[model samples]
Target: MSIKGSLRSRSLTSTPSSILKRPKTLVHRLSEIRNKPTEVKFELTKQLKCIFDGYVQKTESKEYEKLVIMIRDAKLTDADISSILKEINECISILDQKFRLFVEAILSIEWTSRGSEVIEEYQVFIVNLLSAHTYHAKMVIDKLVKLFFPGPDDSDWEDGVPADEDCAKCINVHALFNSLLSEVPMCQAIFVSSLYSHFPYYNKSTHIHEYYLHNLLWILEYRPNLRPEILNLIFSKLIIMDVNAPREEIEKYLNADEEMFLMDEETKSIKSSTTAFTQVNRHALAHTLDVCLDKIFNYFVSECHDSQTKEIIWEKAKNLYLEMLPIFDRLILPTYDIHHVQFIMFMMTCFKTTITEGFLNYLWKKVCNLNVAPVLRQAAVNYIASLVARSNFVPLAMIKGTLQQLAEWIHSYISSQDGFEYVNSDIRSHSVFYAVCQALFYIVAFRYKDFVQSKKNIVFLQSLNMAKMVTSRLNPLRVCQHAVVQNFAAVTRKYQLAYCYSVIEHNSRNTLPVIYLDEKGTTVTSDNTLNTFFPFDPFILERSAKKIEPFYKEYQEADESAETVMEETSEVDDFLLNEFPNSSKNKTQKFSYGSSPGFKFK
Candidate 1:
């Protein structure tokens, strides 16, 4: 027989039951019924509605699982997937609240694991759903947000799939969001809301928060207009974690040299037994704060470097500083006892001198504004003193000018108190005054060499009338931090700028009254001594310190004979240990008076 006749005979002999049949996939079935008559389409829609209704009713049905499996396992072409999605988009009327499970099943598919073509098709389908039914937008956005981080049980691989595939998944998710944002501008609000709402709890695992923070920062690149909101949200969440993790605990754990203690089993046992539980949580939190701030600081650095030209980078850094000011005011300024979050501003200042000046002016304004809360004002001055003292970029002229301003304010405050017959010398009532004095003394102590560098500078420093301020009845020398007072006394006496050691001696012999009246008409006795609370003392976070340390100024030891310096430091330590006892042991820095424990010598 001829070849054609042989093929025809074989085709005729092949029976329906004898041939292997290909199972109909969900995509194929949908495409077939989509172009059929209206009656057939109605029946298909009715069946889907019934299946989803059963799902909602908690009825035992395999249809939902079967559909999910088909979506998950079927190796459909891009055209086929698009066809299926197009048909679903047409049936949005029937796919209402009742069909949520069906929509979720579509969303749950690991389309990111598929090819680029499949991801694009899946994105298109999502855009269509969001455009046609705005109500499901939250559900869609929520699912995408959840994919930002890995699950607790997830490993590097599971069932032959690399868990590192989350990188690809995150890329696809952000791409889908970009499309949604463009196609449906209104979705931006929902997207931002979703981001804020889905932020991992503060106590969540470190990696989880890191992942989410990274994605949020990625969003900032495309959504430049949303920079303020996104960054504000970040700072808000960061501060929450920051305030909860005590500064002392963070310093202890972060500065700990784990390798050094390896052979000391006794030390390990003591630490583990006394502080294992509390320390673990605190350490984890501090670590998270460190890492998150590192990421943000790195991002800031990258933004500045994006431009090759120094001028452009400087301009960008300036703009970024301006943008972050409101965020700092709204989120960081008023909040008290936050250890490290404010370094975001510090990092920005490192980019340019003008940026540093701008930040100082911002803080100084807050310090001088009477409308601002007293606590906030005190916090502002603390920041100014710390920044000026610790930033290497701040010019000496600016330091002198800042000192002059602080002196002027102190003198004005003392003059204002002259009108009252009975002066309330209480530190709490006069906290801002004492705070300003502390700031002046701190700046003078830290930068005394700058003032004495030339005759003109020395003359300018002496003209500030530090003598009258120290001798006033308010007694700032008595109220300021003892370490700061001692340091100031040593530096000023050496420079002959002002003599305060006598005042210091007097303060050492007597204790200030600690009783204060509360709003409830109750007399409360509390230790209201102003702490040496320098907010920008040191950036000790392991990861981001590289960016910060180069610009950071460490506390320099006074230029004096070794014996003299040691004698002074020893005297201060004895005084603090005698008076504060508990805090003095933990809070005081070695060799450096006025420096907190966070301070470290180069």
Candidate 2:
């Protein structure tokens, strides 16, 4: 065979080039048909329908990865999407303006996986599609505001902006948004409000947040009459939102609109500011509230270094708790369950409050019916315990059934270990023993102090009796971390299910793991998102850990009389150090200290 023929001698003649050639022809044919007004219209409409169908198919939970693959494999992925978008350079390219609106509306569909690359591709496609035909794309401006300026509709946000993001595409979306801002006053005003109402870069020293607020104020100041109706509608949606603590700076922006607009004596055609502001936009408020609560939840639970910000956030969180109290009664209590419990618990965590009275009452009523399993109850108990600390004064309204369910869990574990043949493992017996010890510790040291210390201390709650059997093997400290993950998987939630998954991922893996130690020695799980803030109060854990270094020389001692250190440090123990070893917990700076248990340290 000739050189070219020799290469095709085998049956593998239809190579990558052949496959590309076919699709290339299809694309070429599609391009050529663009010249014919009708054919271009027909194919464009057909392609849109295909994209929409693909989008709908991809939305089902089971189809996440498969849809991503399909989208990746599609002939129109990426650049092809770019090419189709390019054809739409002018708003008037289509036959009708109404038809033009439909093209922009379709961009709202989520076309890819939640991964950065996928979201970026989809965002680029939308940006290009919109940027190409600004005249017709204004319908999407508010929707774009919802997706990009602050974040996307789903849980993941712009993710990286103004930080590790140096890309031009990653340039502050405010600029592109501002270009169209002057064109659409109402949309511009709302977009400005959204950005203004969002969390600000207080730490970054860029009063960009205030800048947006000022712009909105400017618009209301300048455009008093042209479309007061549009402005009213925009500001109306903004006020009704259920946001968390608005920054201390919010007073200026919130008050500015009424202060500036109401002054216009000549704009009487518009309704007075008081009349127009009938109801607040709960959705916008919720979005704002959700973000702040998320930050608080991270500080309360994530393992970052302590900072002044954490303290400020904690107080802000307390106010949010009072605000969300009604939600617990109405939405969380009657409606939630074991399936939704993790999400509910996370929301509670985010809100940084104890389970409300009505919520616990509702949960208690629901749990007794056996619809929820003991594991879920155990999880609820764990979540409840997490909220209590040395600094936290917790009040348990009702502990009756909580104690009984806990005892029942212990009994089941004991029964699981009935056979005497097992030699090496005490998991079944150990689990029961630990549960008993924990309950006793709670009821003894904290609740029934008199009952535990008095002559009636024996109170021979045989279930609570297992503390003696378990304390030798397990410790309350280890239980706090290990039991939490196992238990939370059993319980409920109202918002952000992905948070639980993120918590689990951080706890179980070694992804820059940092465990924040609370006053009670319980470890709060942390994640990558939380690295932004110092996760814990430095005064508590950081101070304690810091003080341990000075006493390292005293760690090794011959004072058997003084050695009161527990024989076991951890259930999963490594050999005790004879000299202080480098701690990987901190990135640098090792302490020179002799190794021995300093009884005072514990």
Candidate 3:
């Protein structure tokens, strides 16, 4: 008879002595388990542990997966599974070793392809592993990997450990990981999926950040069989799980790894040796960025509930944006899709804290489009204008038009609760309408070139600059561009005021149009000096070119006026006749601006 059948028969029996008691049953079982001597108990425990492990392995095995599929098809919900485990607790201790054998047997099967609930057998062990805050999940994984997939000291699975010492070394991590990677795609997919999904739902208990250089190097460089799409997926996960991880972690994983080209460290493994910079492949990087933007925008617009989460997302995303600055800074006119315009905007919003150099130029060439939604296009334009203002660069006509577009978009998205300026102080901060004063300075100064000939555009630029200049809310009537006090006696020239204001901002918050150049000869800047944030007015830069004259004469006309005058005087009457009709031989006159803004004079 089945256990249930037996329980029913006992319940129907008339004898009161047959009535069962609940409390002592567990106590009696405990006594029975402990009654044996030390040696016998140890041996028994060991044997049963092996059996339990086997059971887990069996559940994981492909050959017996028919059993697993049958269980899955049964679709016992999580509640049913929990009840089943709870009821079997008494039976487990007595058959501990036997159960382990079953567990390991199940574990041996590949679970990667199976979806979420495939966590069945391993969940108990995983809970044990995490009990005391398993330092980091990675450490546990490393230990577990070593236990079943045993490997020795100094044996790197990635680069073949030096063959000379190899036979003595431990099993290669690559061997197990390679097998697991192939055997359990869905397992990996779930691991990554859960990890990536957990960012916003953060509890110190859940944010088990254990991944280090070893795993990252494999995911990034090797694993060719992995769908390359997984990379895009991984990047999206990082963006979504967005947390303000230490900047050092970013360096630790990607930059500190000597094997990765993104790092500056010297080569370690000769087989994978490449420059640190070369480690980040542009195509791969672009693909990752493309997906990250998509995920972030989607989450922000759809799922993100509060500004706090959005800020956290932005903080995490900002680091990624900074990492990509090298690529974006290098390319001016990269061929891009129209969809990318929105993505660029997302990046600007997230990383607006650090508006990269050449970024505006990049957007102008790639994302600016009138063919799209006017408001969307305007957002692009306004963003460029804001960058122009925030940066010390001279904002040209195209850039000014962009700022106008942003202004229009601001009006359009005003009703939007897309986690920006809908409630709190965001508008007071990152929004384009309330951008920094410097962005306007560049716009006004640079726009003169394009608008000097057009009265209407010039008026528009002046109006925008004037609006930007009214920097205070309380005193909107006043234009206080000069009132924001500046410190650091670096560059004293008005021309360099903007550079001085920006170069050292995070530490010293001075956002004025000023540069405090070092006292002239004491600290002169070199031609090669790198000031990524400082903008050079092209007209101002052109002055450094040396003037060259055509050499059509037998001897070049005397460069020195003294020699020329001497030659003319020596020629006596020939020069006296009104310079012989003003030197048919040659002519020269000094040029000057003489109070004109154009600085052009004859």
Candidate 4:
């Protein structure tokens, strides 16, 4: 008879003892499991499998909770937890429905009493299990990424109509998975691989595509090793996602007008529709491209060290640069001005190792290309200037010629403001002037001292001198006489003031006497040599030096007297201090006083 059948039979028995007696039930058997350690382990495994089977069939059972209580009540050891994990791993390929339940049960082992080491011991297994079951892991991760990076879609937003219980369950699952991933660093590789593979399928209308890119970027923050491949993928997408919108269609939507315009017979509906989709993709791709560029540049600066890695990164970047060169302006024109600067900065920053004379000349061509937007041209100038200031990649000899070219360009912009008619207004010219000035400041701040020490490099020093002279003649407010360009003037003025302030800061803080360019082209460090344009007051520094000199001399005399008294009182001779290893007063004080800033005695 079955257990239930036996129970029914026992209740109907005539004898009082038989009436009271009952056959062992499942629950009774479960209670008996607690009586012995070996029996408990066997019962635990059987109960887990039964719970899993019931879950697979969609049958109701309170056994999951009962198992939790059993594990808690039995105080399972690490050996038991490992056994449970092994069983779960074995059952994973058996039933798809049981996968999540098995994962939950394995993770539920009372890590507190079994000791935290139990989790560490099984973390690798958990990571492998998740990786082997890639589809389920990706589904959970995708849901979480969508929640975190909800794009233009309004439906997934939290402020939308209330989410049902399933959404909450997904969120809780994501948290658990995230916590698990954080603890197991090795699992990140699997997660990143899975996320990266989803890129080709990201063209859907839903914000799933946007979420996909955002997650890739999110992963990059923690895993910088993936920079090169991620950058290559992003750059490849750049060419693929180019927007070829008709010039007329783009202009029509620039200013949003509520009034409906009559459709022109000349307009092609097919082209307009294509343009709209292309525009959206281009905008999205631009953001992704920027993130890729930013991450790649940051990695090169901070974490990139292996020479082999550097060569690989350089080749990938060089290929992208060549590929993107043709479509650069077509895609970027008429976008946000900051994006223009970012594009230029990325181009400049990503090539640290492969910068050549050809590349420098190419950037020079861009800066001097009057046909280009004044803003972009100025950005090019800033990039070159930063290269000149911070990097030794550019040949020092070539920098001289580059500076000469830039000085002439700035003079041309200032003289023929009307030729800047290609731009919107004189504001463009003023901005160009301001950028040149800032560039000059960096050049002077960088190379001026080098010139001072190594005066024999006359070619570079002369080029720098010419740049300084050009800037000195160009008045800050000369480009914008009209009130319309006052904001631009203010901006130019800010850069000028910044340059002046930086010069003064260096002058004041420098310990050596400041150097000045005299009209006779003589560099001097003398206080009596006056240049009204010079920012620092030499007389004040001299006076301060004089005031402190006597006091310092008195202190020196007192120190000398003390030294003499010590010499007379001590039995040890000065020769002992020089010759012996452990002599008293082996060390002596050296005092300095009366030195001016930017001065050093030969």
- Best model per lDDT: 1
Against the hidden reference, what TM-scores do the models get? 0.78, 0.28, 0.28, 0.38
Per-residue lDDT for 1-602 in model 2, tens only?
Answer: 68877777644765755767745567778888776553111123234334334444565333323333333334444444544444434322332343443454345444332344544544454455544455555556555544332232222224212323222332333444544455444455455455444434222111232222223333333443423332333223223221121222233333344332122335543232222434322223333433322333333333222365543355544544444444443333332121111232333342333433334444444433356554444433433322221112234323433455555655555555555455322223243244333443343222332233344333433344433223232333233333222222211111111112223333344445345766799987644221110011111111122322222111121223322232355421122221122232233123221111101111
* lDDT of candidate model 3 versus the reference: 0.33
**Which tens-of-lDDT digit does each residue in 270-351 have in candidate 4?**
2223343342332233333333343434433433234655444555455545544443444432232221122332333335
Write down the RMSD of candidate 1 (Cα, Å).
Answer: 12.2
Candidate closest to the true structure, highest TM-score? 1
Query: Cα-based RMSD of the predictions, in order?
Result: 12.2, 23.4, 23.0, 24.5
Worst 10 residues of 4 by lDDT: 531-540
lDDT of 3 by residue, 300-383 (tens): 332223355544454444544454444333331131111122233333433333344345655544333445443333334344
TM-score of 4: 0.38
Select the stronger candidate by lDDT from 2 and 3: 2
Each prediction's Cα lDDT score? Answer: 0.73, 0.34, 0.33, 0.43
- Local lDDT at 184 for model 1: 91
Residue-wise lDDT of candidate 1 within 16-40, one digit each (tens)? 6456776788999999988665421
